[model samples]
Target: MKAWLLNDFGLDNLQPGETPTPTPKPGELLVKVGAVSLNFRDKAIVDGIYEPASVPKPLIPVSDAAGTVVAIGEGVTRFKVGDRVNSHLYSTWIDGAPLPDAPAHCVGMPLPGGLAEFMIIHETSAVAAPGNMTDEEASTLPIAALTAWYSLVDYADIKAGQTVLVQGTGGVSVFAVQIAKALGARVIATSSNDENLAKIAALGADALINYRKTPAWDTEALNLTDGLGADVVLDVAGGDGINQSVQATKAGGKIAQIGFLGGQTAALDLMPLIFRQTTIRGIAVGTRTSFERMNAFLNDHVIRPVIDTVYSFDQAREAYEHLTRGAFGKIVIKID
Candidate 1:
C-alpha cells in the first residue's frame, strides 16, 4: 500500500513510498481509508518538535482519519465489511481514564496511522461516525471534536445559561464552540479578524472578541458575561492564554487546557487561582467511549464539521506545510 512514511523527523523526510498493506489479525478490522485530517500535532511530529520517543522506525503519521471497513478478522463482531469508521486517537484506552500505554499507543505515533491506503486496527478501538457527515468531516472527529467534548462535557459539566470561553479559531476551538452551544451554554469565541469572528458567531458563539485588537480579552469576557466571568474556558493557546483564561473564568470555574499552539510553557501566578478556587485540567484527546459519545452528539445535533480546505492524498507534504501555517477550521486530505 502507498503511504506517506516519516523516514526521519522532518517534512522533507516525508516521502511517497510503499509499505506492506497490513492484514487484520483476530479481533481486528482492515479499513480502506477515505480521508485524513491534519492536526497541529501532526506538523510537530514531522518537524521533530513532538517528542514521543517511543514510536517505531518508518512511521505513518497523521492521527485522525475516516475509512470504510474492507475486511473483518476472526472474532470481530462489532463491525464488518462496508462499515464506515474513524481511527481512534488512543487505541488501547477503550473507556474511562488513560490506560498505561495510551500515550505511546496513539495513532500516527506508535501505530501506523491513516495517511495510507489501508490500516489494520483493533475492532474495539474505533467507533461509528455520524451518519450525516462526509468522510472528510468525520475525519476531524477523532481528535478535534473528542477533545472539545471531553473538555466541555466531561471536565466542566457545562450547563445552559453559562458563559463558555474558547480561544482562537483552530480545530479544537471551533469544535468547543459548537459543543458548548449544543449543550445549552452561551459561547464566547476569540479570533484576530472580523471574518473568523463572523464564522464563529454563525456556529452559535453568543459573543466574539478580537483578541488581537483587545489584548485584554479576559476583561472583555468578564464584561460580556456581566462582570461574572465565564463558567468554563477552553484554553487552546497554552502559555499565551493561561493567565488571561484565569482572569476570564468565574470563581470555582474550570479551565480545560487542550493545546500548545502558543508556547509550551508559561509563568503562571498561583495567587489568583488560589483566591478564585478555579480548577485547571490538562486534556489529552480522549478515549474511544468519549469518541462514541461525541459522535452521538454530532448525529443528534446534525452538527457538520467546519472544514477549511481539502487536499488530495498525493499532496500530503503540501498539506503539512499548510497545516503548519494554521487554518481557521480542520484541514483534510481526500484519499483517492
Candidate 2:
C-alpha cells in the first residue's frame, strides 16, 4: 500500500513510501479510503507544534477520512464489507464526558490515521456516512464538523432568534454559521478579508465584521446586536482576543471554546466571568454520539460542507501546505 509516512516529526520528514496493508483484527473493519480531509492540527503535527503532545514518528497523519468498507473482521456485526463509513476521531470516548485518554485515542496522533489508501479501524470507531453525502463531504465530518457541532449544539444552548458570533472563516467557524442559520439563529461572521466575509455573508450570515478593519470587533458585534451582545460566541482564536470574545458575549450568554487557531495560551481577564455571568466552556472534538447526531442534522438540513479545495491522493503534501495557508473551508484529498 502507498502511504505518506512521517519518518520524522518535521515538515521535511514526510516522504512517499510503501507499506503493507494490515488485515482487520477481530471486531475491526478495513476501509478502502476514498477521501481524507486535512485539519489545522495536521499542519501542526508536521511542523512539530501541535500542543496536545509531540508528534508520533513513522505514522500516517490525518484524522478525518471517509471510505467504503472492503473487509470486516469476524466479530464485527454492525458494519459489512459494502458499508460506507467515516472515522470517529476518538477511539475510546463513545459519548458523554470525555475520558483521560481521549486525546491519546485520537487518530493521526498516538495511532495510525487516514492519510493512505486503506485503514483498519475498530468497528466502534467508525460512523456510517449519510447516503446523500459524497465521500469528500463525509470525509470532513469526523473532526472539524464534529467540533463545530459540539460547540454550537451540545455545549451552547442556542435557540431561534438569538444571535451567534463565529470568528474567522475556517472549517469550524463556517460550520457554526451554517448550523446556526439552520437552527434559525442570526449569525455574525468575522474574517480579515472582505472577499471571504462576502462569501460568508452569502452563506446566510446576518452580519459580517472584518476583524482586521474593525480592530474592536467585539464592540462592533455588540453594536450590531443592539448593545445586548451575542447570545453565543464561538471563539476559535485563543490568543489575546479572548478578552474581546468575553466583551462580545451577552451577559449570561455561552462561549464555546472550539480551537486556538490564532495562538494558544492567552492572558485572560476574569472580570467578565464574574460581572457578566457568561459561561465559557472548553471543548475538544466530540464523541461518537455527537458525530452521529451531526450527520443526521446535516442530512435533514441538506447542508454540505464548504470545501475550499480538493487535491488528489498524490498531492497530500500540497494539501498540507494549502491547509497551512489557512483556507476559507475544509481541504480534502481525493483517493482513486
TM-score of each: 0.97, 0.97
Query: What is candidate 2's lDDT per residue for 198-253, written digit by digit as tens?
Result: 99998999999998899999999999999989998999888878889999999999
Best by lDDT: 1
Q: Which ten contiguous residues of candidate 1 have the minimum total lDDT?
A: 48-57
* Candidate 1 lDDT by residue in tens digits, 1-336: 999899887789989899998989999999999999999888888877788476566899889999999999989999989999989988888888767767778889878889999987788997886778889999999999999998988889898888899988989999998888889999999999889999899889999999889999999999998888999899988985698899999999989998888899998889988898899999988878888888888888878899999999999988888888778889999984
Instruction: Indicate the residue-level lDDT of 105 in model 1.
Output: 80
Question: Candidate 2 versus the native: TM-score?
Answer: 0.97
Candidate 2 yields a Cα-based lDDT of 0.88
Error of 2 at 282 (Å): 1.2
Clashing pairs in 1: none
Indicate the TM-score of model 1. Answer: 0.97
